[model samples]
Target: MSAYPSHPRATIGRYRNRGAYDFQAIHSVVNAAPVLHLSFIPSETDPFPTIIPLLGQMGSFANPDADPSSEPLDLYIHTHASTRLVKLVASQTEDGEKGLPVCASAALVDGYVLALTPFNHSCNYRSAVLHGYATPVTDEAERLYAMELITNGLIPERWGNSRVPPTKTELQTTGILKVTIESASGKVRAAGAANDKQDLENEGVIGKVWTGVVPLWQTLGEPVSNEHNRVPVPAYLDNWRKEANERGEEYAVETARKKY
Candidate 1:
């Protein structure tokens, strides 16, 4: 197992020591995030970048069960066929998944650090950025694989719990973007506030300001079934909710530690 070699663009500049090139660390950050922000230029003539909130998972369909640390992985994004991004992808004629160049970013904010001074304030967080080339998947088998991968990634056994397979009409409207990840990196800030010694010594500032962390967490609400639905919530779903909340709780605890 090896880390993805750092690319010039993927290199972290600020807080350089915090940069993490480990594939597992980077992949876990991306997978744990609730939503991925996908950014890309719509066209060469377009001046502004287009950004969209997306749901994605990284894996190799050839060996989907393999640990992400072992080798290269691709990011699969589920989308609709008529989306603007999809239109641009279909318009492209490049080879080798030559659809569009994109950057995928994911982040988790554990807490806010209220420092003695505004300049010293920070947040406990984990973030990851991945650069890749995305192309619309045309293969039927790969499409199905991506669909199931996303479903199970968010909620284990969700695909089976729902309809076993999508209908032809459903598959026609659904689309997947396969991004071949070229470079990626993860950065994390878990320490507490780093207020300057001078600020700590200021009696006037200390008297008026309360400095500490307010922990934040992502929690799942109780499941609510639709009026027409009669099936009870599955055990796997309940377990997944507990696991997700526990992960958030662990990070909240991490942010509560004394500044390292």
Candidate 2:
């Protein structure tokens, strides 16, 4: 595990204070979800937050420096060349008086918690948040590679069956942005509420408030094809649906737990 810089208030018991910042951990979390909330406030004039759903990729690049242990970059997302978000990022200037965009990247890891402590508590989750500036990926080759990285991240074997390399027109119209993680924090809360020992003893088994954990998880579902379609179901889709059925009961239980 790569050592992440510690914050005084973030350290909690057995929550794994140090998580690997290397490519593996970053890629796993980024690829697990199809969409993430990308937040930004363009300037001081706008006090409210604008959140956008972003498709992303994560990987390591060979740092040109002579150092063998190159730094890992967190490549978050891209957009069409004409997107408003792309224009905002590209036109930004550091005039020393004008406002610069503030971008935040976030991902939710897992959900598992419900409790009845001093107050009736029913909250549980694992999540990570990153705050940084958005940098444009200017290199043509790098931008193309970033697109492939994102596509493969979403569907592991998708590129093999999809269209070949991008065309010149395609490349000309896409904008890729990389966000190097400056500071990030993750939180985990699980198990029943942490009431005082005396309070628990008093409540015993008579407390009216329900207290327990209901885990939440994402599950693949059966594939539905168009009625008029004649093509056979892909092998990968068929296998995924089969596995989901086998674990349907467990998935249901987890889903029910989350509702509480």
Candidate 3:
């Protein structure tokens, strides 16, 4: 399969060696991230860009069962109808033109790298950037599909396991935006701190400086059921939490291994 053609603007500027355009690498980072930050020009008249932290996932309902590891994916963002973002996009986007130009980004910090020098300190991280055109979803079925996909992204098979279906009022108030990604890239840093050889040879500096990576990860806390609830925590939820924490913790520790 052809790789995503990199746009001039989408190209990585600094640390070019870290840039990646492989779909699997980019998609994996996006899917694994817990949060995504979406930014766009809400209006031609507004002074600053509008940015929002949104819950989103990347997939194509047209081919719902397609393997994400190989197929291209579109970002589906969940939002409320009343938000400024929705209102602006609704007003500005033309009928046929690529809806609204937008940028979406996600990142995971695996470890804190403390180097011998202040300037050398960095983090073990993985991140993805997508440049795309986002259009407000108008079709009813497509909207629901996006909703279910996003919910499952949060917790696998959560939609079917929850209260059967949403009410008309609930559906009315919610909005979903589907972003067709144009050009994208993923970037990563890892292994451990890379400090200067001169600093390592300096006995005083070596003795005085504490240089290493502090592994970091997101742990899923125990689920607390509401007072009205009677059921034991379902195996799905229980297992999801345990698996999530274990995966995160493992990556955090693995990224910190010294690369000698």
N/CA/C clash count, model 2: 0
Could you tell me every candidate's TM-score relative to the true structure? 0.94, 0.71, 0.95
Residue pairs with backbone overlap in model 1: none
lDDT for each candidate structure? 0.85, 0.57, 0.86
> Which residue pairs show collisions in model 3?
none
Give every collision pair in model 2. Answer: none
lDDT for model 3: 0.86
Rank ordering of all candidates by lDDT, starting from the highest: 3, 1, 2
Q: CA lDDT of 36 in candidate 2?
A: 64
- Higher-lDDT candidate of 1 and 3: 3
lDDT of 2 at 7: 53
lDDT of 1: 0.85
Cα RMSD for candidates in order? 1.7, 5.7, 1.5
How close to the true structure is residue 123 of candidate 1, measured as C-alpha lDDT? Answer: 84
Superposition TM-score, candidate 2 onto the true structure: 0.71
